[model samples]
Target: MTLIYALEIIGTFVFAISGLRLAAKKHMDLFGATVIAFVTAVGGGTTRDVLLGAYPVAWVQDTVYPVVILLAVPFTFIFRKYIVNLKRTFFIFDTIGIALFTISGMQKALSLGIHPGLAIVMGMVSAVVGGVIRDILCNEIPLIFRKEIYATACLAGAFAFFLLDYYTTLSENIIYLITTAIIIIIRVVSIKYDLSMPKMKG
Candidate 1:
């Protein structure tokens, strides 16, 4: 498989795990957790595909995505104790998932003749909308709605991808790696330093 496709599968798995973790914490049953995992894995991509008029959506076309999510549910259950013991497990997986999804989304958009500016927006949407849906379903405030640098990190990565692809002769794989790393680094640093966008004043 191509690097981007592999990354997309990995992203789906991690995002499903993140959602399953939350569902477990919420005392959800297996079916509910599976639902949560499915949405969290592909909600953003589904939204992006619909907006871009890419019919059938992504997970709809590829059985692999659903299979990955299904595997994630059992994996999360089997590793529940270990996952619970890990500090920031949800954040780590979610961050990595978004970083990878951002690159995939932008690349897809650019390939489809989307404008760079809109492509950046699509990238951010692909990265964060899943988490947004996950949070809403879990009855928590979505991270992007908060002042945290969540979607902003995705935006930065998307811009980096655009600039690198436009100006440099770097291989596509290298660009993907650099963009993903940038998003993950920005996310980690922002959370570590308790950094966030300024709150709106009344």
Candidate 2:
């Protein structure tokens, strides 16, 4: 499979697991957890596709996305204790998911003849809208709505991907690697240091 397809699958799995882990923490039942996982895996990409006028969206076009998410539910349930106990488990998965999806989304848009700037925005949408919807459905404050540097990491990575693709001669693999690494490092460092956007003084 191509790197883009691989990233999509990996992103779907990690994000689904993240949603399942959160659902477990919230004491949601199996059905509830499954719904959350599905939404968390497809919400962003679906939104991006719709906005870009990509027909049928992704999940509808590919059965693998939901299948991966469904499979993740059982695996996560079986290993709930181990998965949840890992250091920064949610943060780690969420960061990786965003990193992978951001570049994947940007590449998709670019392939469709989208402008680089708009493609970057689409990439951020694909990386962040899922988590936002997941938090809203769970009745929690979405990280993007808070002072957290969550979506900013996605934005940075998408911008880097755009620049590297348009202005440099970097190989596609190198561009993907660098963009994903930048996003992951930004997110990890932000969490470790409690970094966030400055709040408005009320």
Candidate 3:
């Protein structure tokens, strides 16, 4: 559990740094960048926790969360030039983070006796809300909307995780690894092909 907590916290920090770097790119002040980063890191988990009734929220209880985010601010500033080009790099890491988080969310929800349908929704929420918050803070449309495959990839992974869970023949670690790989594969292919949800003409 310690290692799991460390990884999740690291994911949060990476997202936070990514968001702060973006804010810096837009010439935002330190405070604004910090806010953006902090929100981006934990927004998805917070949303998932709320929906799962897993309150009063994970970050609220963990002191390390805010501290790690605070540490990310300096890293963002110091590496502004490199970090600014991180749209591609961040996409890869963020995708992995969500995949892991998605599986974790589903496992937790199901263990707590949640319905499968709702558990699936929880997985997607856990996966993508970080980018949504980052986009909102950066004054851009949500990434999951513009890049439809991002969330959908997570959804696909969530579904696969559910199927694996239903069978339970696979080891827990194997299931999670497969679920993450499914998300990464779908997202990479979608981006490569410029795939998107069809725009509607209202």
Top model number, lDDT: 1
Which parts of model 1 have CA positions greater than 4 angstroms off? Answer: none
Off by over 4 Å in 2: none
lDDT of 3 by residue, 36-84 (tens): 8888888888998887788779889988888999998887668766666
Estimate, for each residue in 69-188, the C-alpha lDDT of model 2 and write its tens digit. Answer: 999987887887777778577678889999999999989889999999999998999998998899988989987888768888989999988888889999999999999999999988
Tens digits of per-residue lDDT, candidate 1, 1-202, equal: 9999999999999999988888888999989999999998899999999999988898888899999999997788789877755858767888999999999999999999999999999998898899899999999998788877888889889999999999999999999999999999999999999999888899
- TM-score of structure candidate 2: 0.95
Instruction: Tell me how candidate 3 scores on lDDT.
Output: 0.79
RMSD of 3: 2.0
Instruction: Give lDDT for model 2.
Output: 0.90
Predictions in order: lDDT: 0.92, 0.90, 0.79
Please list the residue runs of candidate 3 whose C-alpha ends up more than 4 Å from where it truly belongs after superposition: none
TM-score, per-candidate, Cα-based: 0.96, 0.95, 0.89
